[model samples]
Target chain A: MDPSQVEIPPLKDLTIENITENVHLINSRCPNPRLKYLMKSLVKHVHDFARETRLSTDEWMAAIQFLTQVGQICTDVRQEFILLSDVIGLSLLVDSIDHPKPASSTEGTVLGPFHTHDAMTESNGGTLSHDPDGEPCLVICTVKDTSGKPIPGAKIDIWETDSKGFYDVQYAGRQEPDGRAVMQSDDEGNFWFNAIVPVPYPIPHDGPIGKLLKLLKRHPYRPSHMHFMFDKPGYDHLITALYLRGDPYETSDAVFGVKESLIVDLKTVTPKQAKEYGVAEGCRLLTYDFVLVSDEEARSLREKEAMTAMEKLGLRMKLLDGLPVPDVD
Target chain B: MDPSQVEIPPLKDLTIENITENVHLINSRCPNPRLKYLMKSLVKHVHDFARETRLSTDEWMAAIQFLTQVGQICTDVRQEFILLSDVIGLSLLVDSIDHPKPASSTEGTVLGPFHTHDAMTESNGGTLSHDPDGEPCLVICTVKDTSGKPIPGAKIDIWETDSKGFYDVQYAGRQEPDGRAVMQSDDEGNFWFNAIVPVPYPIPHDGPIGKLLKLLKRHPYRPSHMHFMFDKPGYDHLITALYLRGDPYETSDAVFGVKESLIVDLKTVTPKQAKEYGVAEGCRLLTYDFVLVSDEEARSLREKEAMTAMEKLGLRMKLLDGLPVPDVD
Candidate 1:
């Protein structure tokens, strides 16, 4: 291309058809290959989304303000942006893409805003919930490899909402965390904890994401479930949940975190059986097993997916060259 | 659609193919038509962008964090999100879509972040610049309707950078505004002001937008221009600029706000001519005319465009229904 012959296409009088193409070409000289690709793709999609909706100036301004409010509301303890991501299903999608299951391992779920570190290590069968107005329940689980070998001393970080459906952080007065504990599997690869049965709860509705949910007439309920993070040396850390089988929102969880393999049944135990476990009469008991994948396998799977993704991106880039500009008149 | 025969499709264990569909169905109960359409379309495009990019979990989180920073950086006087919008061309696109131009009228441009109300009214041919080191220039303009009729009493709000290419905002110590004034047209529809010829300058490069431009290997210089807002009783308010011809960045404005029709030539004045404006010998002069469209015509054009946009969106919705879930495998 001769410098004297260079055609300076007027970018000022833009029409709908050429806007995306011009945006795509604007930052073609970005230094980092990945960042450039991401930025270009972002410009294309965001611009197309607006054009596809014929988004008015008023609507665009409203979105900008909403995002500002969401950002302003975030603090160290609260992340409205993450909540926005989760509610929009982006969180779960990213999780699935990064962690492809090998058919035998525990499925991934969304790490909701309620998750907090509880370093208090509890002995097997110890209580986690301290709320008086809670129904007693026993959680029993074994950590094992995909081949069914016992993985003793695996640390299990667990949390759940109280029976009334509120996390410890949501309470006004409590300082110490409740309904949360960290326990390790015994020599037999068994871990058990006494706690109140978790119940479905509405996410915080005072913020921008909640307002958007309200506008969508969408319920913000996450199904009754116990949050669990299982980790041990030389193994992949698994973030998952044990959702109650019959919970009303089991299939309609607002964050789309439910998986068929993660849903477990609860059985009612007699008072005599409960006494042996040092729990109250008619306590519910849930028993399940978690299968961990090896860290090597997880890494390999991620690499495979990344390669496939690059190939797909390559294909999309070709189509970007002959982009169709729809007639605006 | 009998209740007894209602089938419950499993929402659990969703693959990439079905996730977007599930999100589309998640809020089927939204009562507002436009909100529903916007939300559904947003889900489709956002999801598609992620899939097309094969976005990693880390990349998605980084985007969320970047957006949060953009939001947090905004204050009453600063808006980083709007800056982001301008740099990405969304702001200009929205402005163009909302304010379509008639064939005989002046074009619109982005209302940049430097815009502020200049309540200090000045008579024709008064000085607007106060910097002692500034070069002298004369600005003369006439406000007229599309039919070439002079529009008396039309208010022209003008602002420009100093000779060194800094707005009053770029100065840290000044409280009183400089380089801006509101002047009314005379009975013959003429407005003139004495000021320095504006120089090209980089936008605030200390923010996230600046960092992004650096990473993209892009320059942040806006072409030298005078910001003008013309308003009258029954006419559409026109926000435009008189960009200097042959300016280095005229064709490559950082914000893509330059239009060929808005670019005007500057003529160097003789010392005798400069004496008439009480300016230096090497001062410049620019003469231009702005044609405004009636409010009613602007409204009719917007309505026609709205109908066309709806038809386009309707067609896109049909394509979304048969959305080709590409073979990601």
Candidate 2:
């Protein structure tokens, strides 16, 4: 059929139809070759969603307002909107989709929202948990290859919430990086630290994400967990967190970061066993091991680790480096 | 290669191959199909954009901060982020791509950030310029079918700025509804109104978008233009704006609402012709006619119009109606 021969409708009859056609055109214009297909697909889906929903003028305006608020609440230190992604499961989903760990190793989990780039590194056996008030516990882990060979000189980056589930940064002045630490495994790939058994606690509920969850009748609790990242030469880097067995929210963490493989049983050890590790007996002791893949795998793992870390914390790209970044995503 | 024989990388190794792979899996778990796709696509492009730009942590964080401010300045009555969209050309591109008016008709333009839901309707020759303080001018437009037949009872929604480029809403005391009126064309497909010649003006610069322009060393001026929406039963609706023949920023409108076909000369008419139109001699006059396509073609046009409106206004589906709205085009 000739293009001109197609009978064109008048303006009054065209409001709905024009929207459909225009979306297709816009999809064709994206400059990023890699993103063009994805962006076009997204635009198609988004336009379809709008049409299917029969969105109204007032409602559309409201969405604009909501997003604006999301942007507004973000700051140098606060990323309520990123927290919104966590609660909505988008952040975790993105992490999992982007970084599929091998089925054999410990599963990774949400990075939570409190990671700081300025975490101070410590020597082997250094304890991150500075508070002496919480229940005393010892965490022991080994870094090794898939074949069970030890990975000597591995750096074990560790952090965790206090017994009450608060990060050191959450109480900058009052808390001195309590329950948070970075330590290196010994030449034998063994690492140990003392801290309190973290308790399940609610995520910050004073922001828009919290408000949205409240409106949706959802909880904001994350299961008790400890964060660990292992990196060494000739092996894949691993950034993961271990959840405590049997926390109330273990099965339903708000951020969906819990994995059965990452759960460890905290055994109550006697003083004799604690003395062998230079700690008192009757303290909680948890043992786990992280197995790394080859060096190529480690590089890929690092990218995945970084992306997850950034997404979970709602840390914008600007915080990664002081430069202007586009808001495409 | 046999699928089973393919060597599967260890969980740690997999992390190094592609960060997006991890994100893809999590996206699969999203309950909402739309959100699933959105999250997956967003992460992919965001990561890709970052990698392409070699984005650093600080730059990414700054982008987040910028977005946060965009949200902060937004309110029930004001949307600075939408203004951000307008300045970025994304809104116009989205709208034009979504709603491609037939090449023969007057191309649609940006709806702008100042549109209100309620513009008072008036009869033929009704005055919309409530304030008489600005320069005296007359606007005459004919609404016709493809064959040049007049379309009676056609609605013409008209709005523009005063000589100082101020809309009625900009000044609470000077005028109730300055330079804004909605009227229906007469039986002969003709409509006329008395108003002031609009001048070029700068958008509000106290918000985040303003800050962005300052950082980029760009200006925020929009050329003089008039808004129009023509609708009649059994025909398509035409939403557009016409630019003055030679406004300073006509070639580079901040919102990108200008189009060649929509630019018109505002002729200074003789006293006799002015008297015939009930205006004084030496008054500026703008005469133009809007030609609309049939219903089918107009549907495509309206979709584009809506998309453009959505983009220019920083509109989101959440604001629309709690239902998914397609924004692809």
Task: Report interface Cα RMSD per prediction.
Answer: 6.3, 13.2
Kindly list the per-residue Cα lDDT of model 2 for residues B1-329, writing each as its tens digit. 11122222212212223545654553354445454544554555554444333333334345556677778776544668668656654455444543456766667666677766577887766777865677777888888877778888887778887767766666645435557887888888888888788788877677777765554445577788888877777776567888887777766565666778888999987888787888888998988988876667766445555555556546553322223344444
True contacts kept of 2: 0.11
Question: Number of clashing residue pairs in every model?
Answer: 0, 110
Supply candidate 1's per-residue lDDT for B117: 74
Task: Give the alpha carbon lDDT tens digit for every residue of B16-131 in model 1.
Answer: 66789888786555666667778877888888777766666667778878888888887755677878888888888877776778889999887777777743688987888987
> In angstroms, how far off is B84's CA in candidate 2?
2.2
Q: Best by TM-score, which number?
A: 1
Judged by DockQ, which candidate is best? 1
- lDDT of all predictions: 0.78, 0.63
Model 2 residue A280 lDDT?
Answer: 73
Estimate, for each residue in A58-96, the C-alpha lDDT of model 2 and write its tens digit. 444555666776776665446776676565544544445
